[model samples]
Target: AQILQLLRDLVSERDTALILITHDLGVVAGMCERVNVMYAGMFMETGSADALFARPRHPYTLGLLQSVPRLDAGRRQELQPIPGAPRNMLSPPTECPFAPRCRFEVEESRQAVPPLEELESGHHVRCFNPVPAEEWQRTRVGAA
Candidate 1:
């Protein structure tokens, strides 16, 4: 925590740009203005942190957020983990890398790579089918 504070101070004092690469959403929320969600070593979603967190357009990004433990959640609340393990990078499939585990998988996503599409101003996602914010939240709650 001290180190993170120091880094934050340095950036502010020096008027410098900082690129933080981390899997911890808490850190991202605390320090980042923008965010890039990566899977299989490739970015699946890129957007402002607020936009991405409020309504993730990529299934992988949604899965990641849903899997985190929320402080406001009930004590007995169960974590909604992503259904399957990550794909092997050594033998990557030509199609959408997340298809094997994504619930919104479509035929095009399985047959060909999905290009990043801008769904909103400054929000982009590489997915053929994306779950709306409400549906994703519903699914996450239902799964738990």
Candidate 2:
């Protein structure tokens, strides 16, 4: 916590940029202004931290958020682990790396890689079948 505070202070005081790379979403939420979610060396999503947390468009991004345990969540709430093993880096697949584990996978997702498409201003996602806006909005409301 102290280190994070120091980093934050440096960014504010010096007016410099900091590139933080970690698997800790909590830290990302606290420290980052913008976030780029990656899978198998490819960027799955990129957007403002607040926007991404509130409404993750890509399946991998959603899975990552779901896998994190929330402080306000009930004791009985379980983390939804992303199903299936990670893709082999040695022999990367031509299709979307997250397709195998993604619950929202569609036929096109398996045939080719999806290009990063901007859904809203500054919010981009590399997915053929992104999570519906209504679905994410509902989840956000429920979580709140």
* Candidate number of the best lDDT: 2
Worst 10 residues of 1 by lDDT: 135-144
Task: Report the C-alpha lDDT of model 2 over 40-138, residue by residue, as the tens digit.
Answer: 999999999999999999988888887887778889988778899998889868898899898899999999999999999999999999999887876
Candidate 2: clashing pairs of residues: none
User: Lowest-scoring 10 consecutive residues by lDDT in candidate 2?
Assistant: 135-144
Best by TM-score: 2
CA-lDDT, candidates in order: 0.86, 0.90
Q: How much is the lDDT of residue 140 in candidate 1?
A: 49
- After superposition, which runs of candidate 1 have C-alpha atoms over 4 Å from their true positions? 136-144
Model 1 clashing residue pairs (backbone): none
- Predicted candidate 1 versus true structure: per-residue lDDT over 49-104, tens digit per residue: 98877778899988888888877688998987899888888986799999999999
